[model samples]
Target: MCATHKAFFSYVWRKFLNMYRFSVISSFLALSCFLSLASYELPDHSNGEPTTDYSINEYWLSLFSGFSKDVDVFYVYPTSWYKLDPAEPDFCAIDHPTMLSRSKVVFDIQATAFETVGNLYAPYYRQADAAYTLSLPADKRWAVVDSIPAKDVIAAFDYYIKHYNKGKPYILVGHSQGAQVLMLLLKNYMPEHTGTYARMVCAYVIGYPVTAEFMSSNKHLKFAESAEDTGVIVSYNTQSPSVAPGANIVLGDEIGLVINPINWKRDETPATAEESLGSYMPIDAQGNPALIPHFADARINMAKGVIECSSVNETDMFNLSGKMGPEVYHSFDIPFYYYNLRENAQVRVNRFLAK
Candidate 1:
């Protein structure tokens, strides 16, 4: 297994600080711990209505949702609920300041890759805390997944359809826990709503699993066989071959559906560092991102069902998988191939519109 969600001071600060440097993002982590605690202390976060209701504008974090783009992007942020208390509820409130701050930073970094290709709309959802979910065995974690986060996200998606979509084609984007939520939505929601499914450009389910078993059972869902494939799912977890040896956090028992962000191929063929279009990395201590060329080389680990990029540095990804055993590059999945994803999204959107 990969590293436990280790409780280290430098780990959280260094990981988040190094990742963003608070450059383009606001002061993300400085108040996160305190703010999360404050959110827990609040007596009434829901205000009579179920806070999960997306009809209320407070539940959305719209970045480019109204941008004049032809396509729309409906994004769900990853697990930002880091107030690690076992006594705390399994899911954090939508108003948890830490989760909201973290969600903003991640939306800027991860979802913005699609901004050039579509108008972006991210919803605030009640996601599980990292430590609580990570503590459970992999198979059992879905119990948490099937509960709050799933409900909030699907409700938000339903809201997006009835209110904002206006018949525009849209792309589904989510990472880590956010990606897991999208998986649930795709499996349970999309099937019944064929009209909405038809308008879906594709899903960028990064840093999570879209396992073979998942695809086999849902005959309507398909994994990305190429960069330009529309109405398909694009997913892969990032890992290093040298790091941990046991089962990873995201890919449970089955083989995950993967595509090389560098080359868009699922097979184990290596995509050299030179083939990369440069990664978004912090240029200095301040965390301003720069397009650093040749940041990583990607190749699929078929047995492990992950994209192994040995070229990545532990400091860059904040060594998120440090406690597990080896490297699980969960944090760097999107940034490592930042430019590639930005371009690939446009490619798929363009292809879909042309048809």
Candidate 2:
């Protein structure tokens, strides 16, 4: 071959190799960018410090102005934190933006049930992830799950009592993990502080189990006998009639007292769907506030310690992801009996006042 032809071919080969190398480098950089965008990380707290503020104005969801009611609803919200860096922290930080946003939606759907009957006071505490209780065996999970979150709840309650409660009668309301924290609060706080127990209207601990052992041990706390019963607990776990009880949410053999919010009865009486006044759905078709009315019938199954509902309008609000079956209606516990609970709160409040 000619020398000129050999030189030209060599130049072409080198250019081709350079272009291929450039393409490979560009593709590698693009893939890295995509992975970074896809990866999930817990929101970074300022200076990596968890918030410690529990002042009524800062944490309370509803701080009524120029209005007073005979009863105050001290509510604890359910599992709103989904992300955790198993290495970084077990309990979610209170001021984390994601936790704050999620807790607001919970307050609207669950806490609003008591708005008409009393002044609502919901505190934002460090709540364990939904899987916190389910990830480990019953014995191990309860201790770890309650450790950090329980302290914040106790502190918040103390703050509420000293500043906001002002000798007013109060109702303890909690759902799912919130209920678990409140159970600890009731057992530890109320028994020692008899004044707080005397002013208590009732405790509505929904979604989580309140075992017979716990109640029997805590003599000051009484389970509700009827709708108008004062200073008692109104608790129940809801599921479809087909779903059996024995889920992790209700630990142990001794299932505690359950009152049917629909019928306001302790027995296995079926309350028709017509009896449910309304359920406050946080979002509408367009993602707006929509308070929907009467979509479920409830009947207590004394054998299982859960309320069996006939129907549920399964929306994003009711959608919960867990090991629990369809029968484990944890999300719909409050909404299913929204109005019934509101009216029952008034009944108990009035009865407490009368006495």
The RMSD of every model to the true structure, in order and in angstroms, is 7.4, 17.1
Error of 1 at 212 (Å): 1.0
What is the C-alpha local distance difference test score of candidate 1? 0.74
Tens digits of per-residue lDDT for model 2 on 1-355?
2456335434543443333221101122222222332233323222343445677477665665558988899998877765434343546667777678767766876888898888888877876554434444555546654576777788888888988899999999998788888898998888789888889999998877787877888887888888888888889987777765565244334365688888888899788877778665433222333445666688988888778886653332222312344445666688667888988899889999898
Cα error of candidate 2 at position 209, Å: 0.7
State which candidate has the highest TM-score: 1
Clashing pairs in 2: none
- TM-score for each candidate, following the candidate numbering: 0.84, 0.79
